[model samples]
Target chain A: MLTILLQHTVFGIVTGSILLLATIGFSMIYTTKRFLCISHGELLTIGAYTTYIFHVFLGWNLLYSGVIGVVITSLVGLAIARGLYEPMERHGPLVLLFTSVGVTFCLHGILEFIAGPSIRSFRTPILPSIRVGGIPLITMNEIVIISIAMGSIVFLHVVLTRTRIGKAFRAMASNVDLAMARGIDTARISMFVWIYASAMAAVAGILLALVTSVNPDLGWTQILIILAAAILGGLGSIYGVMIGAILLGVVMDVGVIFFPSGYRAAIAFALMIIVLLVKPKGIFGGE
Target chain B: MFRRTRIVRRVLVVGLSLALLAGLSVGVARAEEVRFGVLTSLSGPLGTEGKPCFETIQWTVEEINKFGGPLGMPIKLFVADTATDVERGITGARKLITMDRVINIIGPSSSIVVAIMKFCADNEVPIISHWSGSTRLTTSGGEYQFRTCPDDYFEGEVAARFMWDEGFRKAAVITLDTEDTISISDALKKRFAAMGGEVVVDEMVVGGQTTYRTAARKVLAKRPDVLFPAIDLDTLKIVYRELYEMGITFTVVLASNAVQQATMDIVGADILEGVYGEKPANALGSPGYAIFEQKYREHMEDGMVGWFTPNMYDAVNLMALAVEVAGEATGKGISENIRKVANSPGIKVYSYAEGLAHLLRGHEINYEGASGSCDFDEFGNVLGYARIQQAKGGQWVDIKFYSSEDLAEAIR
Candidate 1:
């Protein structure tokens, strides 16, 4: 009984940590940009596919593949900004959000065109499990995932709390036009945010690939979990998002021990509906 | 002035001749390669199902080419990945029609088949779906759309009858509300109810749910004789954990055939001790089972064995046969010849190599496959048996086989 509990918890944590990183990307994008990027899911998928191409096809090490994945996806984010967000910057959130939708479709089309729309994963074996103190530990990939999630979150916390650029970002998030008038380089900062979000998405995608299979829509599906987390955390509040992500993961996974198995998918949506009904601003929405 | 004028005339004549020759060559090469559009999810969530099908097409083309090509002319496959999105599926169909100008297409896997079927019918391209089992795709009575896999309505009837025969009078259904799953669930529920069996519980899980606790409780409350699930691996893991720990034993637990090896590993085989489901590829079968087991190990790393692989392999061989029977590589000719090659009366052949040998002998051949017999009804649905596989001692062991004919009679 104890062993099963430990196993489920470990699995939940590993899975949750990967989701946390992906939600961070959504948090950063929503906070700074204040636009609904429905296609943010595909960016993570691009990262996963990039990892597959570099690591599996070309025989690059996993670490190097991750680097390639993040770098390439960051550039894709920049391109999305330039092509979709940049042109619509002066427009309202609705217009900008719609443009992101268009960008998502175009990118999805290109990927389908080139990759031939098939699920692909490394032919290399899954990392073998490790046991410690009579509890079977997860794979090395999962260990790396947890570490990366913690490291990225801590790093983001530091960057946000202790840096001048972070202050400028907060200022922009507070009021974009006001920050622009105050002589902050708003465009450059927004570009940096895009890169940062894209990089976070890549990390999430890579970790997810390590944990499970890398389908063409794997990252996109992960985005749904991210949305649930972000919305639970108050949409733009990074701290709230992280807490929400972990909690959401636990509810879906850990909470299942006492609940009916088929109702698990309903829990997340149900929570969303409840949160909206009770606290429309989310747990950490605008002050 | 005379030299310059003569040079200009010479250059103009040479350029015009080169242009004309290039155009003529383009037209001739186009004639040499007959195009067949293949619609499958090369991307998206359901991409795994389409990957092996893609390989089967490749293998078929390669083997066919070794025998001096289909219809003594090279066959070119124009593939567009649908990404498993319905809108993208429609776009893929358009691309195949307008860009490839193909006569027939192979897939888009599931309900996406319905969308592509509409387009293929409109464009007059005969389509033989390799994996999608939605009855609506065939029952719509469309002229151009044909499937190589059994419909869920038929498969569901077989499943319900299996439970009935196994002496389980009370059943519980846990299903996802997706178009495909819902279709199978609804059919199963109606059939089970009509079979004088009590459907003690009916629970619908939202698509893509990873947990199954609340729904599991609902199913447990019914105290069903059997629990039938329409779900995938992720949800199955949660279901197994809750069911076993809660001490819910049953006469049998049954589900749709999508549980991969990974799910078993996650929850242990003890929990799935009596679970049963339907599958197309049973290692117990002949011809390609050995080869499939070997190649599946090599190519599909994901540890999930989908029922679609054998049908995928058979679809390719059928296409190769159509090409031979048509004596031409055009779409119209191939479509006209599909039934001849698939359902013909003769000594049967299995592999592409054997198929080629028979083609050489100018002999009509039936292709018996690893999945089952490759007999197609008028609707192009594969006529075969659904084998019942039970999870015993950590493997999906086959306990019984239900033929379509037998199932049809039982359902009636």
Candidate 2:
């Protein structure tokens, strides 16, 4: 019984790591842009497919292909911000949100057209998993996922606290008009945020594809849970989103012990609803 | 008064010409063709199977027209995309019956078929589904409904009996919580219990989730002698990978729903070796299958075919044969003659042309087509054989064939 509990918790953390990576980007984009970016999840799909094209089809090294995929996804996010969002900036938040929904469908359609709406996987050689202290059995892939996610979180914390550009980002995130008045270029900062967040989403996508299988609707399927994480964590705070993702992930995995496995997503949503009922502005939201 | 009389004469001439043209066109349309509705999912997740099924139907119709069609009239196929959605399927069925005036319908998924069963029954249009395997579909008293594939109820019984024969006493099931999966798993569980076997764990996984680690842990804890997975390809891949990573080993008896070339490819041959599965036998040894393979390769992209390809081929040929046997181009006539042309006490014919020739000679014909002997019981369900297959050396190898009687004995 204890071993089962340990196994479930370890697996939950692995799932939580992916959720953390995804929610960070989702929360970052929503906070800076001030509209729900429904197409943000498409960045993950783009990253995954792009990596598959390079590594599997074009015969590139897996790590190099992943890097290139992340770069391409980041560029796509920057393009969306400049080409679509910037042009429609004056149309108010609801219109911008609806436009993102349209962009989501458009990106989804393009993927379906290219990938033929079937599941695909990276053609990697299989490796045996390692047992840690002969207790909880985990795979090398799981270790890699957790390591990268943690590394990114730490790197993001240092950058946001220590760097000049990071300070400017924080300023804009807090008060865009004030930051602009203080001579920080709001447009440049927003573009950088889009690129960075999308890059994070790309990493999440690649890791997820490695863990499971890749399909055109991979990101679309998980967008709801990512949204739940972001909203549960006050929608904009990086650290808050991290905590929220871990909580939701653990709850989802552990909840299956008490309930049937199908209730995983329901438990997450129920937790979110309870949080909202108790604290309407979210657990960490100010005012 | 003179100008008014001239205008009235011009109007009268134009009106008479318009009415005469409409009547002539209607008369020509009625004489030239018989239309049939081909309803199938052409765009969604099922499209992979649905497209090829539709193409087989289309190709068969073309072949029929080349041989002077079923009843000396050119057959016109009116296809409507169901999109694999229930509401769209209902709408498509309605439009086919009401607008296109089709005599019969062919090929939609089980859920869509069930959703539109009453609609077809009300219109008295015969719907022959080639892919749907739900038992409730044929048993629901929709006399107009028929299916070419064996139902899941039989598959479930076979699975339970196979497990018992293999000496697996404690069984665990992990299935997707959909109607089809649930029904099949329920049948298996009930039958397994009836055979005095214990089901240790039954886990229902939701669709579209990234991880099944929790579910995997639960199943592992049960430590059953065998695992039966009735999940989709994607989820199955994840669950198996997780199980392997956790160093858990058990015999996996996959449900027929998970037995596909795509599933094998995605899950990797190394992981899936020795896994047991079952599918409706395609009767690959039959001469009709050889002909189908040769002709199907010429038109299909990638030169690839699925297990259900033969079923689709048989569906089209059966409908055409019934049309020929009925000697008329109406739904009721085809309905009356379908069983007569499919069952025994008749000359055996394989293809549409052979059946047509036999019918033209005033002889009864039984079709043993690419899928197998096309036989339907009283409930519009086929008593088909199931092929027990195992993953061996990166390919599925057929081990044994179990007929309906054999399955019945096992269940008994």
Candidate 3:
């Protein structure tokens, strides 16, 4: 029982880390932009597929494709913010939310047209498992997933807390009108947020392709859970988002020990509802 | 002036009559053609299954056309891809039935077969599947649903007998949460447990999630000697790879679904070595099947036949044969005549041309198809034999041929 529990925890942490990368970006966007970006999944798909084109089609190195995929995704994120969302900013977040859904379907249709919806995967570098006490615990791909997540989390934390632009981002998110009145470059900050958050999402997407496989539905599958984690933590709070993602992952994996694995997604959502019923603003919302 | 106007009007009336005759002739010519629709994953997760099945369908249809098609009407075929999505399956079936106005339809993968079968049946378009093994396919679909392969019940019995024969007393079962896979899991558990085999772990898992490491570990904790995982090839790819990375290997014998040669090539021999699966023994030494394989090699880039490819061939031929048997081309006609053409108490026919002649001569003919006998039971399932096989050096090699008679006795 002890070994099983420990092993499940390890599985939880690995799943949690991927969710962390996905959730943090989602939380940041909702914090500043104040609308759910349903097309975020397509953003992840674009990133993974771009890397796929590089590795599979062009015969580039996987690591090189990963870097290029992230850069391209961040650019796409910025372009979307400028070309679609920014132009519609005056219409309010509700309209933006609806537009995001439209964007999602459009992107999905386009990707399906281009790629034809077959599942594609990368031939990743064979990584060894880190076994302790003569039992295989976790794979090195999982380790890479966790480390990349942690590195991004740390980077985001520093940028948001220690930099001038980070302070401006916070100011705008708290009150966009007030920040604009105070002569803060709110558009610039929003763009920066879009780029950074999208880069993180791309990183998550590439890692997912490495660990699992990539299909057009990859983003759509992970988005709801990322939203659940972000909402479970206060959407505006970075630490809250991180904690919620890890908790969601751990709860989902460990809960299967008690419940059937088919209800794994349900377990995570049920926890979110219970937490919300107790604290409507979310676990970290009161802060 | 009256005579001149009358002559002009008479000329106009004669011209209109001649045009009407031409239109009627065109309509008669059009009616001489029968349309068949194919709904399958031409591009998607089941592309490996769908494309080959489609190719086989085409080949069968082409050969029939050469021999003067069913009811002596040239067969017109239209294909729609579900892309292995359920919603798309429903849409494709609708388009085929309504927009395309096909008299008969065939194919589609098992995952989408339930919804599409229901849709096709509701529209009075009789549909046949190569991969559908779900009981609900017939229960809900009634006379419209048909498949060329045996039901999960037969598959379960076959798998259990193999496990027990191999001296596996304790089994661990993991299945995807799909209705078909669950049915397989249930059938397998029932058969295995009835034979005094203990099912230590039975886990129904949701597919498409990132990792199943926890579920795999949970199964390992119980320490079952054999594992029977009924999952898609893609999900198994992840599960097997994860287990390999974790240095855990369980003796696995999967359902016929896992008998994918392409998957074995992709996963490689290192992980797949000694993994057992079963496919219908139709590929072995049948003169009819040999011709089909030769044709397939000439047509497809990948020459390795998927399990359902021959079934698709059988489905198309059955669709054509039913038309010949009924002497007309309509959904209701095909639905009524499908069993008569495919089921028993008849002379055995091996090909479309043979079946058509037998039916034309007032003979009840059973189609002993390439994929088995295209023989169906009350539930629209057929009894068939499978070739027990094992993965070695990135390919599936036949271990033994398990006959239907022996399987029946073992299960009974």
Candidate 4:
């Protein structure tokens, strides 16, 4: 019984790490823009498909393909911000939110048109499992996913807290008008946020596609959970989002002990609602 | 000036009458061609299944037209994409019914058929489904709906009998939360329990989830003698992978839905070796089926056909035969004569041309379609048979055949 409990907990951590990667970018964008970016999920799809094209179709190495995919996804993210979001920014949050939904559909349609909706598997050889004491069996793919996710989170923490640009970003996130008045180029900062968050989303997408099969709906299907994690983590606090994601992930997996597996999503949403009802500003949101 | 004006007015009147006559004649000529609506999910998640079915329908239409069509007129197809969603399916059905004015419809899924059942019944349009296996679809009293595939109830019963025959007592079932999977799983559990077998674990998982370790763990905790996974290919892959990773070994008796070549290719044969399942059988040694396989390969870019591809071909041919026998291209005529043209008490015909020729000669003909001998019961569901298969040497090999009566008796 104890081993089983430990196994679920480990699995929950892995799930939490992936959700954290997804939520980091999501929350960052929301921090500055103050609007939900529904199209952020498509960045993950773009990343996975782009890497697939490079590795499978063009015969590039996995590492190179992933790097190129992330770079391209970041560029695409910036382009979207400049082309669509920038012009519609002054029209209120609802307009931006609706536009994001439209963009999400457009990206989903384009990916489907290109990939034809068939499940695509990576050509990477399946690694043998490595069993640890008192835990579920883990694979090399899971290890890599966990390491990269943790590494990216730590790096993001450093960048956000220790650098000059990070300080500028924090100021903008806190008060855009004041930050712009203090000569902090809010436009460039916003563009940076889009690129950085998109890059992280791409990494998350690649990791997810490696663990599961890649399809057009790979990102869309998980977007709701990503939203729940972001909302539960208080939307703007990166550290809070990470904690929220981990908590949600553990709950989702551990809840299966009592409820059926189909209720994982419901359990997570229910937790989000309970938090909203009691706390209102999330666990880490400022009053 | 009065004479000139009178001459102009006469010319205009004459041209107007000539145009009206020409329009009426064109309308009559257009009505001579029979239009059949083909609705399937040509895009989205079910696109892989939908595309082949759509292509098969097209191929059947082409072949029928080559043989001078039914009733001495060419057949035309108005195809639409459903995207595997009910709302999109409704839109496609409406377009096909109102805009294209098709005489009959062929769909690739039971869910879509059920969704459009009321509309088809109201409009008196007959819809022949190629691969929908839901029991409720036919049992809903939609007179215009007919299924070429066996219902899930039959599939579930067959699965239970197969398990019992294999000497498996305790069974655990993991099914997707979809209506079809749920029904099949429920049927299996009920029948298996009724037959004095134990059901240790019965769990439902939502589709499109990336992880199934939690579900797999819960299922494994039961430690049943056998596992029955009645889920889609993608979810099945995840669940099976998780089970394998957990160092769990048990016999897996899959539902017919997951027993496909595409599924095997995606899930890897190594994981599926020796797994048992059942599928709707094709007329294996029939000359008509051989021709279909050849033509399907020639037209399909992937050169791979699913089990239901032949059913789509059979559906199109059956509709055409019914139309010919009814002697009209209307939904009421097609629905009224579909069972007559497909059932027994007539000369057995294999191909569309053979059946059409027999029907034209004023003789009753029964169509043994490429998919098999299709005979629909009163509920618009076919009394079908399935073949038990196992994955051996990285390929599916048929081991036994179970007729509907055989399965029913086993359950009893």
The DockQ figures for the candidates are: 0.20, 0.46, 0.38, 0.46
Each model's Cα RMSD: 8.0, 3.5, 4.8, 3.8
For model 2, the superposed segments whose C-alpha errors exceed 4 Å read A125-129, B1-34, B41-51, B73-103, B287-294, B297-305, B325-333, B408-412
Q: Model 1 chain A — which ten-residue stretch has the worst lDDT?
A: A119-128
lDDT of 2 at A154: 94
TM-score of chain B, candidates 1 onward in order:
0.81, 0.88, 0.87, 0.88
* Cα lDDT, all candidates: 0.71, 0.82, 0.80, 0.83
Q: What fraction of the true interface does each of the listed models get right, in terms of native contacts kept?
A: 0.28, 0.52, 0.46, 0.42
Instruction: Note the chain A TM-score of all models in turn.
Output: 0.91, 0.95, 0.95, 0.96
How far off is model 3, as Cα RMSD? 4.8
| Tens digit per residue, CA lDDT, model 3, A224-259 | 888888888877888898999999999998887788
lDDT, candidate 4, at B380: 81
List candidate 4 segments past 4 Å from native.
Answer: A125-129, A134-137, B1-30, B287-291, B294-305, B404-412
lDDT of model 2, residue A82: 88
Give lDDT tens digits, candidate 4, residues A1-287. 77777777777787888888988999999989989999999899889989999988899998899999999999999999999998999998899999999999999988888888467766776544677873456777777888988898889889989997888999999999999999998888888899999998898898888877778888898889999998898888878899899889888887777776778899999999999998887888732
Best lDDT goes to which candidate? 4
lDDT of 4 by residue, B299-389 (tens): 8787766668888898999999998998888899999998888999899898888998888789999888777678877778776677888
* TM-score of every model versus the real structure: 0.68, 0.91, 0.89, 0.92
Least well predicted 10-residue stretch by lDDT in candidate 1 chain B? B257-266
B1-412 per-residue lDDT for model 3 (tens digits):
9999999999999999999999899668658898999988776657666766887888778889998898788898988888777888888888888888887678776667776666677778887888877645544554877788766767787788889999999999889877667777788899999999999988777888777876687677788889898887668777777767765556888776556765664454566788898655563566557656776787778788666877788888888888888778888889888888788789988788788778778999987777777777665677666767898887788887866676777534
Q: After superposition, how far is residue B189 of candidate 4 from its true place, in Å?
A: 2.5
Candidates sorted by DockQ, descending order?
4, 2, 3, 1
The sequence of per-residue lDDT tens digits that candidate 1 reaches over residues A1-287 is 56656755776776678778888888888888787777788888889889889897898997899899999999998888787787887787899888877777777767766776333555444423576674444666667778888998899888888998888888888888899999999888888789998898888887766555565556656666778888988887888888777767766666566554445556776787788788897777742
Stronger candidate by DockQ (3 vs 4): 4
